[model samples]
Target: MKKLIACVLTLVLAVSAVGAMAEGLTFSWWGGDARHEATQAAVAAFTEATGVTVENTYSAWSGWEDKMSQYFASDSAFDVNQVNWNWLFSFVDGEGKSKMYDLNQVADIIDLTQFADAALAQCTVNGELLAIPVSMTGRIFYWNETTWQKAGLETPKTLAELMAAGQIFAEKLGDEYYPLALGTYDKMILMVHYLECKYGTDWVTDNKLNYTVEQIAEGVQFIQDLEDAHVIPSAETLIGDGADSLDKNPKWMDGVYAGIWEWDSSASKFGAALSDGQNFVVGEYFTDIGEFQGGFTKVSLALCIANSAADKQTAAQLIEFLLNSDEGARLMNSQRGIPLSAKANALCQTEGLLDPMVAEANGKVIAWCKNGLDPQFEAAALKNSDGVYADAFDGLSYGDYDVEEAAEVLVEGINEVLGA
Candidate 1:
């Protein structure tokens, strides 16, 4: 009877030990279907290999930023997160303290040496390594060749040709087919790209607006000219489409919205959404856009561990596997942009795993865009849905604000955020 009791006690203790070792982590990110599927598969693989389970939450870009802001503010973020680079700066306190776990604590497991020092530097804040950068990205034009062909022209290689194609497209392919499309935020970024190229300066320097009121008005007018010339649909027309995103919009899928000033990292998602027989191609930076080549490259996204996580080492391990492991790298290839990890990049190039179009776009963005992005530029106050970018351009496009009035609103809003 004593031996029976002893055996029972042993079994109970064994089960308890198993339960203690079975802790799982929570991870979250925002992306399209391809990214969701790939990341889920990678998570499953990591779980199978290490018996470390992960629960993942994901959604498209629409409200993800606001949701993340809430999580971070409450100090209740998930164990791991796929973060926008600027979040490192945006989420910090006045003293520069961050809610991210100091990655130096988990250096024993993660291969930090795999990334470039310059790349890693951008992700650090207040002496804390806030995140691990996945890739660098910059905006460039991507065109649907089938749509351009319908207008009887090749994709434009110069700003003049691009503007000319707009009228030509309107004449030959009906008023519904536009040469390019720019949402409110898209216009904001493109304005910066235009101003940078023309003025040869960063949009923000030393936490102040670089352009004077008149210079900003000129930038706003340039966007207005595009709308007037039919280079892109007016705000009203695009809003009428009623699609959540350009990728889901019917006109884009059917080849009516032919060109986009989009991030290079987004090539696959956008291209895959096009109708069968349509071709998506990386386009050249127009030599005539400005006197100097402009635009800026930034850390497209990153992997981070929350300081509030119950298992910091486990979270770090997950990020390491997703970013640096052979299998993980294979699954995640070019989904987040070109890999910033030297090992992953070399492997992708040698094995031909990197998407050819993505590589081509990244090469062009890196070579021609000569400015560095300011972290404050992507602050939620400016870039979030229904934010200032909308306040300025939406009013301008709807004729509620003229060129000078729109510039006033834009400068005021930008300064408000920067000054804060």
Candidate 2:
């Protein structure tokens, strides 16, 4: 009878051990269906190997920043979070302490050496390694060849050609079609590109505005010129379409909005969204306007551990597997852009998983970009919350403000954000 009791006790301990290994963690991110599927599969594989459970919280990009901001502020974010590059500036305290985990502290579990030195450096803020950068990205133009052909125009290689194509498209395909499509934020980036090209200067330097108010007016006016020339749909028209984002807009999928200036990592989704037989091709930078490259490249997104995580060591292990290991890399592939991990990139290349167009575009942007980007350029107060860029540009688009007025408002709003 005593022998029987010993065996039963041993069985109970085994069950308890299994329960202990089943620690649960939460991971959050923003992406489309393909990313969601790949990430879920990765998580599943991780769980199968490690006996740990991970809960996923993900959605489209719209409103994700605000949601994560709230989560971080409330100390209620997931154990693992997919963070934007600029978030490092906002999430660190005055003394340069991060609100997220110091990834360096868990170096044993996480493989920092798998990433490039420059990529890793971008994640370091205020002496603390805050997160691991997943990929690099920059904005460049992409054209739907079928749409351009339908409008009886070749792919635009210069600013003049692009403007001319706008009129041709309007005449040939009616007012519904345009040579390019730009929303409020899109206009902001494109305006920066135009200003950089025209003036041969960076957008900001030393946390101060580099361009004069009048010069900014010229930039804003250029966007107005595009609208007046019918190069893109009006802001009012996009809003009326009632889509949550450009990618979701039926007009874009149908080829009505034919061109976009977007990140190289995002090329696949845009291409996938096109109708049957529509050809998507990366376009060259408009070199005629600028002697120097106007755009900048930076870490696309990062994987970070929340300060509030109950088990940081386990979290670090999970991140390591997802970003550094062959199996996890295979599952993730290029869904999060090109992987920053040298090993992961090599793995993808060996497997033929990297999207060719995205890979080429990424290389072009990296080679061409000559300017440094400011972290504050993407500050929530400036870009999204206060809608500084959107308000100024959308006002100009809707005729609520002229170029000068819009520029003044933009400068004042940006200064306010900087001061805060």
Q: Which candidate is the best by lDDT?
A: 1
How would you encode candidate 1's per-residue C-alpha lDDT over 218-296 as one tens digit per residue?
A: 9999999999999999999999999988888899999999988899987678899998999999999988877988899
What shift in Å separates residue 62 of candidate 2 from its native position after superposition?
1.3
Candidate 2, position 182, lDDT? 87
Model 2 C-alpha lDDT per residue in residues 16-54, reported as the tens digit of each score? 998787779999999888899999999999999998899
Q: Candidate 1, residue 88: CA error in Å?
A: 0.8
Q: Give all TM-scores, in the order shown.
A: 0.94, 0.93
RMSD of 2: 3.8
Instruction: Give Cα-based local distance difference scores for all models.
Output: 0.90, 0.88
The reply for model 2, stretches above 4 Å from the true place, is 1-21, 93-96
Question: Which pairs of residues collide in candidate 1?
Answer: none
